[model samples]
Target: MTRSQTTLAADAELTGVAFFTGGDVRVRFRPAPAGTGVLFVRTDLPGEPSVPATIEYALELHRRTGVRRGEAEVQLTEHVLAALAGLRIDNCRVEIDGPELPGLDGSALGFAEALRSTGVRELDAPRKTLRVHRWVRAADGDAEIVARPAEGHGPAAAGLRLEYHLDCGPERPVPPQNFRCEITPERFLEEIAPARTFITADEIPALRAAGYGERVDAADLLVFEPDGTVRGNAPRFPNEPARHKLLDMIGDLALLGCDLHAAVASRKGGHALNRDLCRTLRAAATRGDAPITEAIGVSTDPAAA
Candidate 1:
């Protein structure tokens, strides 16, 4: 059975400090028409410039995902994107009053809960889905991500599967962990949304020196200590780090702007590598190099694809 596109039924709001800018920000999630995908409107800007949440507009930010259109940009977008994708929300207008999104709990749970409360409304159009026909891979040193076709061609097989292998190295503060799950709303909310972003304790000083995370504290996110313990927080799961990596991959892949029917495996992959994989997929779709199927229409333009 084909699924219809969906959007929020009513407006929802979230407010908190941005991890990077350390400034208070407010974001409003509003319903959008079918095919709108996810668009971020910078309400604080003069014209309230909007940026489509697609690979075409993605920015290569450090440790986070962002998108830009001319002078307007939205930073720290992974959590929001992950929430929307995990819930299968296809169209949304995310209006924000700041440059960065709220860093609530350093996880997607806040956004997921708000969106769930707002309710999801199905649109009239059939949802677009990209079924990968060939393997696509991206790598950087030891870190890598690979996307490939799922087995069979039935509706049951037309879902996403993700596996992450987070090898922090034996000497690192965090231990190696692995997580694999089929992407679904219930699974995402229960197993993935609450996993908080984490960093090594030693990376804090350099982040501070780079003028980031000024207002963030150990309570905001998981800070792994040298002795393989979290500072001021308990692990949500024994493999919470790997789960968070999977969450990040979900958000980054949302830039593809369609339902992805593929199994993706990531080993120590980060935002840059994830974005690269999206670019590769987008290019393939544009060139008709991949045997992709669409429920409605797929953009062929290089800028839109």
Candidate 2:
């Protein structure tokens, strides 16, 4: 059966420290009307400037995703976007009191839990989905992504599926890791949401030198040593780094402003490459270049069920 659009049932709030700024931030998720799309409002700004959470507004990939509108910008938006998309939330008003989102536990779990507690309310409108009818690929050096037609099964019939692979190299510590799964709200929370973002022990100095991560401690995130041992925190999943990559990918894709129906295979790809793919897909859809398939593995007729 086709799914209806969704938003939060009630307003929810979260507060923590910004990873880069070390400043306190308060974020609120308010339920938006049908078709409103995800939005970020800077409540701290003079005019309370708002920006749509779309790839078109995505700026430079300086370690994270930043969405901008004129002079207003929001940094590190991927985690919150991932939670909204993972839960199949279609519309939301994300109000933040700072330039960047709080880096709560270095994972999307905090946002997910808050949103879950508020509950999801289905809208009257049927969800809009973008189907991939042709193979499309984008790359940046060795990192790459290939999107193909989905094999409509379970969640893939309504949304998308992802197969992600991450290789951190031999010298850096963490070994090669990969994961493949059909994307869904249930699967995301259990398999991907809990996976925290990670950094190598060696990268600490450079990160500090660059003026970032001042508020986050080694224990607050997954930190691996050159000897392949975790520094302070434990991993939520065996291949937690790879799963976090998948989480980031989902957040980046949410900028498409609709549910996606494709099988995306990614290898060592980061924010820049994912942004490029999103732009390419939007262009192809605009030009009517890629063919459209209504459903893949399941019957499209709601009555068929």
Best by TM-score: 1
> What is candidate 1's TM-score against the reference?
0.97
Each model's TM-score, in the order given?
A: 0.97, 0.93
Error of 1 at 102 (Å): 0.8
* TM-score, prediction 2: 0.93
In model 1, where do residues sit more than 4 Å from their true spots?
291-296, 302-305
lDDT of 1 at 245: 93
User: CA shift at 89, candidate 1, in angstroms?
Assistant: 0.6
Estimate the lDDT of model 1. Answer: 0.91
lDDT string for model 1 (1-305, tens) is 35899999999998999999988999999999998999999999998989999999999898999999887899999999999999999999999999999999999999999999999999999987778777889999999999988877788778999999999888898888899999999999999999999999999999999999999999989999999889998989999999999999999999988888889999989999999998888777777774543323568553553
Cα lDDT of all candidates, in order? 0.91, 0.85
